[model samples]
Target chain A: MSILDSIRTALRAIAANRLRSGLTALGLVIGVASVIVLIAVGQGAQQGVQERIRGLGSDLIFVKPAAQTDRSTGARGAQGGGITLTAADADAITEAKIPGVVGIAPQLSFNAQAIAQSQNLGVTIIGTTPSYADVRDARVAQGAFIGADDIDRRSLTIVLGSAVAASLFPDGDAIGQQVRIALGPQGFNFRVLGVMEPRGGTGEQDNYAFIPVSSLSARFQFLRNPRGDISVNQINIRTAPGAKQEPIETAITDVLAQRHQVVTPDFTVQSQNDLVGAAAEVSRTLSILLGSIAGISLIVGGIGTMNIMLVSVTERTREIGIRRAVGARGTDVMRQFVTEAIVLSLVGGLIGTGIGVGVAMGIDGRDISGTAMQTAIQTWSIVLAFGVALLVGLISGSYPAFRAARLDPILALRSE
Target chain B: MIHLENVEKVYRTEAGEVRALDGVSLDVQAGEFIAIMGSSGSGKSTMMNIIGLLDDPTAGTYTLDGADVSKLDDDTRSKLRGRLFGFVFQSYNLVPRMTAVEQVELPLLYQRGTNRRAMALEALDRVGLADRASHQPNQLSGGQQQRVAIARSLVVHPNVILADEPTGALDTRTSEEVMGIFGNLAREQRITVVVVTHESNIADFTNRTVRMRDGLIISDERRLQVIPSSASSPDASIPVSEVGS
Candidate 1:
C-alpha cells in the first residue's frame, strides 16, 4: 500500500480511541513542559546574577582582611589575630600608581544609633574616602557626596543611604539637618550632605550611612585597635573603562604582598567578573541537573506510548488480517503503526511547548523565598524538547510495529 | 485459470504434525463458479488457503494465469494476490471505523495505476449498496456488510474471487442475496468464483461442487447454475451452459 494510505488508516484507528490516545499523549506533554520550565528558571537565575554584577560595575574589586572577623560587631581583627590592613596600606596601594587603577576607597564600619529630633534608629556608620561613591556604584540623588575637602578638614558631614534617609526623615528632607550619632559612650552631631539612590538587592551598602574615614578617626577614638592602628576592614578598587581586571588584580596582590613583607598575606582580592563567572557556571550546572531529572519523565512517557501501541496491536489482530488479506505488505503495516506514534508525540510536544512557555512567562520576575526569579524560555530549548518527543515515539513504537508486521495472516484471520 | 497438483499441507503443532491437505489436486477455469464442500478438519479451508496464496503448501505445484506462484516470497505473493484474486470471509472482515466506500477502496491501495475513489464507488454501486456507501460496518445489517465485502472484492478487478464460508453468518434470505451477487459477477463479468462451505444447500447455487472428507476429495460433480431471480433483478440475465444436475 502507499505510505499516505497507511498514514490515513493509522489516523482513523487513533481517532477510534480518542480518549486513550489523549491520555497517552498527556504523559509526554507533562514531560516536555517540566523540562522547559526548569531550564527557563535556571537561565533566568543566571541572568539575574549577571545583572546584579553589572549594577556593581564589572571592573570593580574588593580587598578584605582575613583577620577582620565578626561583621555585626565591627572588625574584631585584633582579637582574632591582630590587625593587618590600615589607612596607610590603602594610601600606599593608590600611590604605587598601579596600571588600570582609577580609584580606591578604604572602608571601616561600626553599628551606631542616629537620633534626629525625637526619632531614633540604629544604622551602620560606613567610614570611607570620597572615591567610595564611584567605586561602589552609588549615585547621590539629593546633594553632593563626601568630597575631598570634607575628608581633609575632618568635617562632620555625612551621606545618607536611601533606606536610612527614608526612615529618619519620613516627613521631609534630611539634607543639611543635624543628627546625633552615639558611638560607644560618646555622641557626636553630624550634618547630612546627600541621599544616595536606591540599589535594590541584599547588600550591606544598601542600609548604611556614609562618612569620611578621617572624620571617624578624629572624632571616634574608641574605633581604634589595641595596637593603636586605624584598621580598615575592606578596601574597594575601581578600574578604568575597558580595562582588564585580571592583570590588575595580580599586580595589586603583588604590591600588597611586597609592602606587607609577609610571604602569605592574610587577605583576599576578588574581581567582580570572577564572582559573576562562578555564579553563571553554577547556574548552568543546575540547569542541566534539573533538565535531566525531568528528561526521565519524557522517557517514561515514551514507555507509556509503547505500552499503548502494543495493546493496540493486540486489539487489532483481526484488522491486521483484513489489511493483509487485501494485499497490504508487511512494510505497509509497520509504517502505519510507526506513523501513528510519531503523530501522537508531535501533537503532544506542541501542546507542551505552549503550556511551558505560558507558565514560564507567568512566573517571570516573581519573588520566591526572597530571591526575585526570572524565567526565559529559549527557542532552542523548545526545538530540543520537540525533537526528543519525536525520537521517543520512534524508539518506543518500533517493537510494536515490528510485532504487528510479523503477524501470521492465517492465524490473525482466524482470531475473533 | 488456476491449477493445483498434489497439494499437501502439514501443520506442526505441539501435539504433532497434522496433515491438513493430503495429495489433493484440483483445476478451475476462468468464469467458472465452483463450491468446495467439506466438514470441519476435512481440508477444504486448507485447500482454499493454498489456492489463495495465503499459505504455502508442504508439497504442491500451484499455477495461476501461466505463472508458478506456490514457492513465491511473502512480498511477491502479496503483490500477485492483489492483482489476481479478491477475498471474502464469513465474518465480512470489514474494518470497524471505515465507511463502506473506504473498505471497498482498500485493495486498490496496493495496486498502482488505478483511480481509487471512482472505482470504489462503482464497485459499491455494483453490489446494490450505492446509497449506503457512507455507512460504517456497525450501522449496516449482516446482509449489507456482506455486500460491502463483495464490493471490496470487486473494486480491484481481480481475475478470481475466493470466499471462505461467505454466508456462514447470514440468514437463508441474506445468504441467497449474497450468492446472487457472486453468480452475477461470474456470469456477466467472466470472473472465476470459488466458495468453500459445509452446507449442501449453499453448494447448490454454484455450477460445480467438490466434496472433501479427511483431507481428500471424495467426489466432484457438475451442476446447473441456480441464480435466484428476485434479489438480483437489476443484473441482466446471462447465458449459462446447463450441465449434469
Candidate 2:
C-alpha cells in the first residue's frame, strides 16, 4: 500500500474507536502546549528584567559588597555583607577625581509606613544624596529635590515618589506637607520637599521616599558603621555622555581597594551590561529548565502513544490476519500500523501547537493580579514541538507495528 | 492445474513430534469443485493449509499452475496469493466497519490495483449484492455477509477459491445458499473451488469428496450430481471436463 492508502486505512481504524484515539492524542497535545507556554514565560521574565535594568537609565553602575572566597578554609561570604561600603568609601571615590565620573549617590533604604494624617501607606524610605535625582535619571515634578543644605544640616526633609505622593495626599499639592515616616515604634515627621516624576521601572522608582543619608544615620543611630561613619547600602554612579562605563568602574574599584588597604576592593561594581547579561543568563537557565520539564511530559505522551498503538495492534489481531489472508504483505501491515501511530501524534501535535500559541498570546500583555504578564511566542518552539511529536510517534509506533507484521497468518485468523 | 506429491507436514511439540499430515497426495484440476472431509485433528486442515500455501510441508513438493510454489519468498508468495487464491471463512471474516463495496475491494487494494471501486461493484453484482454495496457488515445478515465475502474473493479474479468450513456458522438455508454459489462459481465460471468440512451434507454439493483419517486420505471419489437440485444449479447433464477453463 502507498503511504496515502495506509493513512486512509489508519484513519478509518482510528475513527472506529473515536474516544480512545482522542484520549491518546490528548497527552501529546498537553505535552507540546506546556513546553511552549512555559518557555514563553521564561523569555518574558528575562525581557522584563532587562527592560527594568535599562529603565534605571543607561551608562550606570552600582556598587555592592563582593562575596569573599577564603582560600585556606574554602568558605565564602555572602554578598551585600555588613558595612561593605560607607560614606567614607564614597568620599574617597569622589576625592580621587575618577575621569568619566558624572555623579555619585550613596543610598541606604528602610521599609517604613508613611502616615500623612489619616492616610497611611507602606513605603521604602531611601537615604541618599541630592545627586541621586540626576545619577538615577529621576526628576522633580512639583518641587525641588533634597538640596546640599538639607544633607549638611541633617534635616528631616523627604522627597515623595509620584505614586507615594498621590497615595498620601490625593488633593494634588503634596509639596511642603508634613508626613510622619514610622520605623517600628518610632515615628518622625518630615517636610515633603518634592514629588518625583512618573518614571515606570519595576515599581521601585515610583514607590520610594527619598531622604538624605546623614539624616538617616542621625534618626537611626544604629545605622553608623563601627568606624563611626554613616553606612551606605548601595552607591549609584553615572558616567559622562558617550563615555564607556568600564574605566569608571575600574577606577572606583582601584580607589576603594587602596583606601581599604586591600589587594582587591571589599565592594563589587556592576555595570548595565553586566546586569543585563546576568539577567539573561538566569532567564536562559529558567527557559531550559522549563523546556526540559515540559519535555518529560512529551516523553510520557510518547509512551502513551506506544501504549495506545500496542492495544490497537492487539485488538485488531484478527483484522491483521484478515488483511494478510487477502494478500497484504507483512510490510504493508507494518506500514499501516506505523502510519496509524504517526497520524495520532501528528494530530495531537498540531492541536497542541495551536493551543500553546493561543495561550501564549492570550496571556501576553494581560494583567495578572497587578503585574502585566509579557510573552513572546517563539517560532522555533512550535517547530521543535511539532518535530518532536512526529519523531515520538515514529519511535513509539515501530514496536507495535513490528508485532503486527510478524504475526502468523493462521494464528491471527484464528484469534477472535 | 494444481498438483501435490507425497506432501508431509509435522509440527514439533514440547513433548515430542506430532505429524499433522504424512505422505498425502492430492490433485485438484482447474474448474473443479471438491470437498476435504475428516474429523478434527484428522490432518484434513493441514492438507488444506498446504494446498492454500499458508503452511509448508516437512517434505515433498507442491506445484500450482506450473511453478514450484513451496520455496517462494514472502513477497512473491503474497503476490501469487493475491493473483491466484480467494478465501472464504466459516465466520465470514468481513471487517466489521467496512462497507460491502470496500470489503470487496480488499484483495485488489493489497495488489495496488486500479479502478478498485468499479471492480468491487462488479464483483458484488455477481452475488446479487450490488444494491447493498454501501452497507457495513453489521447492517447485513449472516448470509449476506458471507455473500459479500464471496464477492471480495471474486473481485481479485483468483484461479482458486478456498473455503474452510464455510458454512460452519450458517443455518441450513444460508449454508445451502452459500454452497450453491460455490457450485455455480465452479461449473459456470470455470473456477476451482475447494471446501473443507466434516459435514457429509455439505460435501454433497461439490463434485468430488476426499476423506482423511489419521494424516492420510483414505477415500477419493466423485459425486455424480449436485444434491438438493434447484433452478439455479448448474446443468446436471454436462460433463465436468467438457467445461472450458
Best by TM-score: 2
**Interface RMSD for every prediction, one decimal?**
1.0, 0.9
Q: Kindly list the per-residue Cα lDDT of model 2 for residues B138-183, writing each as its tens digit.
A: 9999999999999999999888999999989888778878888888
Candidate 2 C-alpha lDDT tens digits along A1-416: 77778889989988998999999999899999988898888788888988998998988889887787778997887876555788778888788888898888899977999999689999998899988999998999989999999999999999999999999999989999999988876789999999999988677779999998999888876676767788897888888887888888889888888877888677889898899998899999988998999899999999999999999999999998889888998899999999999999999999999999999999998999998998888888888998999999999999999999999888898899
Query: What residue pairs clash in candidate 2, if any at all?
Result: none
* Clashes found in each candidate (C-alpha, N, C closer than 3 A): 0, 0
Q: Quality of candidate 2's docking, in CAPRI categories?
A: medium
Q: Give TM per candidate.
A: 0.89, 0.91
Candidate 1 local lDDT, residue B204:
70
DockQ of each: 0.65, 0.65
Global CA lDDT computed for model 2: 0.87
All candidates' chain B TM-scores are: 0.92, 0.91
